[model samples]
Target: MDYVSALLPPVVMAAFFIALVVTIVKSQGGANKAKEDAAVDAALSRAESARQSQP
Candidate 1:
C-alpha cells in the first residue's frame, strides 16, 4: 500500500484539475460579457451623475 498512498494525493489533484479545465472549456461567453458590460455601464452612469452633482 506504500505506492498507492504515495500516489493518491497527486491522482486526486490531477482529477480535480482536469474537471476544472473541462468546466472552463464548456462554459458560455455571451452572458458573462453582458454581465461585465452592465457592470461597467452602471459604474459609468454613477460617475456621470456624481460629476453633474459637483459644482
Candidate 2:
C-alpha cells in the first residue's frame, strides 16, 4: 500500500530515535560520571592557563 509504505519509514525512524535517546539518558551520571567530569575540568583548566599565558 502506498500509505503504509509512506508511513513505515517515519515509524522506523521514530523508533530508532527513541532508542538512541534512551541509551544516552541511561548512560549519564553512572560509573563514568567522575571520569567525565574530571576530563572536562582538566580541559577547562588547560584552556584557562593557555589564555592567561597569551596576555
**Top-lDDT candidate index:** 2
Off by over 4 Å in 1: 30-55
- List TM-score per model, in order: 0.55, 0.89
lDDT of 1 by residue, 20-41 (tens): 9988876646668788788999
lDDT (Cα, tens digit) per residue for candidate 2, span 1-55 = 9999999999999999999999999989999899999999999999999999995
Cα lDDT computed for each candidate against the true fold: 0.90, 0.97
Clashing pairs in 2: none
Q: What TM-score does prediction 2 earn?
A: 0.89
Weakest lDDT window of 10 consecutive positions for candidate 2: 46-55
TM-score for candidate 1: 0.55
